[model samples]
Target: MMRITDHPVLGPLENKEVTIQFNGVDYIGLENESIAATLLANGIRTLRYSEKERKPRGIYCGIGHCYECRVTVNGERSVRACITPVKDQMIVESQGFQS
Candidate 1:
C-alpha cells in the first residue's frame, strides 16, 4: 500500500502516472506532478539530511521557496523537487554530504 490507496479528500488518487528513478531505484509517480508530491504520495519522506548537523528534512512549505526539498536531478546539485515536474528517465538522488 505504498501508493495512496485511498484518500478522504482526494478520494483515491488517480492521474497520469510515470516512472522515475530515485537513487538508481525505479518508482511510480504521476506526470505533471511536483517531485515532492510524487515522493510523498509514494511514502517517501526525509528528502535530505543536513550537511553540517545531519538533521532530517522533508516538505515543509510545499512550495519551491524552501530548499529542504532539494535533491539531485540527473547529476545536477540542489534541484528543488517541490517545483520540478516528473520527467521520464530522470535520475534523482537524495542530497547527502557523502555519496
Candidate 2:
C-alpha cells in the first residue's frame, strides 16, 4: 500500500476519490493524490522501462527530483508523476524509447 497506509508524518491524505485512465485502462484514484502515489496505492510499479537499459523503475523520490516516475500526461512527454496531481480525464502513459 505504498507504506503510506499508516504513515507517521503525512498520515492519511485527504481527497475525493476519482477515476483516471492509465495506459488506456481506467483506475480508481484520489483527486488530491500525486499520480505516482495513486499508482503505488493500486499496486502499480515500474512506471516505465528505461530506454537503453530497459530497467524497471517506479517512484524513487516522492519529491519529483528523480525522473523514475515520469509518464506522459495529455500528450506531454516526461511529466513527473511524483508531483503532478491526479486529475479526472488525465491521460497517462508509460513512455518508451520510441515514444
Best-matching candidate per TM-score: 2
How displaced is residue 96 in candidate 1, in Å? 1.4
Local lDDT at 71 for model 2:
94
Candidate 2: global Cα-lDDT? 0.77
lDDT of 2 at 9: 32
For model 1, the run of ten residues with the poorest summed lDDT: 1-10
TM-score of model number 2: 0.82
Q: Local error of candidate 2 at 3, Å? A: 7.8
Per-residue alpha-carbon lDDT of model 1 for 4-55, expressed as tens digits?
4343333454477789888778888866667777788777887888888888
**lDDT tens readout by residue for model 2, 1-99:** 443442333345555777878888888787657888788878787788888887777889778677888899999999998888778778889987523
How do the predictions measure up, each by TM-score? 0.80, 0.82
After superposition on all C-alphas, the RMSD of every candidate to the true structure, in Å, is 4.4, 3.3
